[model samples]
Target: MIQPLSMRGRHAVVLLVEDNEDHVFLTRASFEEAKLQIDMRHVDDGAKCLAFLRKQPPYEDAPSPDLVLLDIHMPRMDGYEVLDAIVKDDALRHLPVIVLTTSAEALDIERMYGMRCSSYIAKPLDFESFTKAVAQLAGYWLNLVVVPHRDG
Candidate 1:
């Protein structure tokens, strides 16, 4: 008989694609302060994000992310390109991606939705608002939503 998996020890893997150091720190701190029980892996560029997801070369042991928090503007590939590639890849397309960026451009929002982003959220400038938003997002995605298991 197969042993049951322990939920306490199994934390969701989150891939954060962000280039700005300040933003990264803020995002990390916000998540931590929110008491989220998940493993967050940071990628400074879209290329590295893709590489990690694909488990290419040096990232051979990288875990497949349960969710991806993407920033629209980044060096190398950018969020749009990364999203497109993810959608195109049969093995990775099922992974949920949320666009968490400072961009309020209508075109960007429309295009991201068209490409099947789980959701698009504009980053709040104020620390309080930012923390609240991050906490809510974490609660909703991690608790409310029924994510597909890795084997599924």
Candidate 2:
């Protein structure tokens, strides 16, 4: 349901926090067919996600992402912790974050919403379906919605 608009606007940066390499690859592949230009970065864990957003040591020069795709379960820190941190941080709270996880439990979805995530999506098991879902999601959020500029 995406309207065909000029996809040449400012490149939207997306940070994907996923520990699974295969899921990361699938997301990358899905973006290949996007109608809008996007700059996607991948972090393996919640801790790294926070680090990337905070411009910490290794990620000091990392740009602030317009959107974030977060995974629930990760070593060191979980998505809940990252979400908590984001909500608490004055600099990062305004950024939109979408929860991407395998759990479709009502509690999980509710909890994510309670934490003020922009959206909650469960990963599809089928590759084709997964790709399609991601495409649709990307289309809706990136193409249809207006992304706000991040103030320094």
Return the top candidate by lDDT: 1
TM-score of each: 0.92, 0.90
Instruction: Please provide, for model 2 over 1-152, each residue's C-alpha lDDT reduced to its tens digit, 9 standing for 90 to 100.
Output: 22222243557788999999988998888778544477899999999999999999799989888889999988999999999999999889988899988999999999999999999999999777887888888888777776565634
Best by TM-score: 1
Residue 137 C-alpha lDDT in model 1: 89
Measured on C-alpha atoms, candidate 2 has an lDDT of 0.86
* Distance from true location, Cα of 64 in model 2, Å: 1.1
Worst 10 residues of 2 by lDDT: 1-10
Model 2: how far residue 35 lies from native, Å: 5.3
* Runs off by more than 4 Å, candidate 1: 1-9
